[model samples]
Target: MRVMGIDPGTVVVGYGVIDSDAGRETMIAYGVLTASVKEKPAQRLSILYKSLEKIVLKFKPDAVAVETPFVSQNVSSALAIGRAQAVALLAATNRGIPTFEYSPAQVKQRVASYGASSKEQIQQMVKMQLGLSEIPKPSDAADALAVALCHLSEVHVSGLLGEQTPKRKRRSV
Candidate 1:
């Protein structure tokens, strides 16, 4: 399966692509799409949407996974992140690709075996899992990769469960 992961932000949106088959995985691409803070809010969103559209077209991933924004006391920041995440969803949905959402904690847990894993831990785990020589740059890209890995792990577990035979339920007297 080919998966594209997105970490949405108004100023810098991160993206990562990977292909998984059987048990092996390969990193296809990972990077960030930036928009100037000086631009108007609409323009910034436009920039992100268009850039993500181009990426979706180029890589043509089978599934798109996005990291949900971490809710915080900053209301405006949270709203902006939500808008950026919508852009990512549109980029995939417009192309008829399946999209999944994963919370930051879930991504961290799947990648690092702990829901509260630190950024450095996530970066290290992502690097080691992908067999990269060093941690992915700019942090955001590493985060995006973690999102993708989380989706991959979820799908793998689901598939394994699907393969198992179900036991019949018994009614109590």
Candidate 2:
């Protein structure tokens, strides 16, 4: 399966694409979509949407996994992240891809075997899982890869249990 994972943010959205087959995961591409602070909020969103569309077009992922926004003390920041996530989802949906959202804790636990694993630990694990020599640059990109790995693991387990589809929560707009 080819999967594209997204770590969405207004200023810097990270993405990772990977192909998994026969219990082996291979990294295809990983990078961040950076938006300038000088741009207006709407303009930043436009940039994010365009960058994500380009990725989806280039990779043609079968599935998209995205990190869900965690609750934050800063409501405005959370809102901005939510908006960015929405755009990311829309980009995938427009291309007929099935999108899955995972929480940060779930991603950490799946990738590192600990929900409380630090960012460094997650990055190391992602590198180790894919047998990469170096950690993926831009922490957010690594995080996105972790999200995709988590979904792949979940799907594998589900298949073992003879399930065709994994449980997913529908996001209400």
Candidate 3:
């Protein structure tokens, strides 16, 4: 399956694409979308949405997995992240692709095998799992890749249990 993972943010939205087959995952692409901080909130979201939409069309992923925003004391920041996530969902769903969301903790547990794993640990593990020569640049991109990996792992486990689909939050366009 070809999966695209998103780590959404107002200023810098990260994305990663990968292909998984029979327990092997291969990196297809990883990068971030940036909008100037000086831009208005809505303008920034528009830029992100357009860029992400182009990516979705270009790669044509079979599924999209996005990381949900972590709880924060800064409510506004959290809300902005949520908006960014919605943009990702819309981009994929508009293309008639299925979408799934994973929490930051869930991503960490799946990629690093520990719920409380640090960012460096997750990055390192992602590198090792994909057999990359080095850690993926830009922490957000690495985090996005982890989200994709988490979804693949969940699906694999579900298949092992004789299920047709993984038990995850799913949204259709």
Candidate 4:
């Protein structure tokens, strides 16, 4: 199964695709989509949608794993990121893909064996997990891959689209 991971932001959206089978995951594609600060909020979201749409069309992932917006001291920044997060979800849902949202801490714990793992630790762990020679760059791409890997570790593709959804929602963990 292929999972598309997303790290959403107004200025930059990171995406990573990974294929998992028999408990092994291989990296398929990873990159960042950038939006200029000069663009308005709506324009940025539009760019994000179009960019993510193209990715979904190209990769044809079985599911999407999105990083939930992290809390920020700045309300405006947080809200902007929340909107971008919604766009990421929409990008997958529009294509009839099931999207799972995970927090940064969740990704870190699943990928690096710690909830407070550093960014460098995450990059290294992701690289090692996928057997990549070098760490994924731009930070965001690695983060996205981490998100994807987390979902793969926690849930299977069948669970993503089946009756497991309600059980997943009700789980305390």
lDDT of 1 by residue, 1-173 (tens): 99998999999999999899997889999999999999999999999999999999999999889998898899888888989998899989888887888889989889999999999999999999999999989898999999999888888877788832111211111
- What lDDT would each prediction earn against the true structure? 0.88, 0.90, 0.91, 0.87
**If the candidates were sorted by their lDDT against the true structure, best first, what order would they fall in?**
3, 2, 1, 4
- Candidate 3 residue 165 C-alpha distance from true site, Å: 2.3
Q: Put down candidate 4 lDDT per residue, 1-173, tens digits, no spaces.
A: 89999999999999999999888889999999999999998998999899999999999998888888878688888788989989988888888888888888988988998999999999999999999999998889989999999888777543666645423522121
Tell me how many clashing residue pairs each candidate has: 0, 0, 0, 0
For residues 1-173, write the lDDT of model 2, one tens digit per residue: 99898999989999999999899999999999999999999999999999899999999999888888988698888888989999999999998888888899989988999998999999999999999999999998998899889989888878999986566632333
Off by over 4 Å in 3: none
- Most lDDT-accurate candidate: 3
Give the higher-TM-score candidate: 1 or 2. 2
Question: How many pairs of residues collide in model 4?
Answer: 0
lDDT of 2: 0.90
For candidate 4, the per-residue lDDT at 30 reads 97
What's each prediction's TM-score? Answer: 0.93, 0.95, 0.97, 0.90
- Summing lDDT over every window of 10 consecutive residues in candidate 1, give the lowest-scoring window: 164-173
TM-score of 3: 0.97
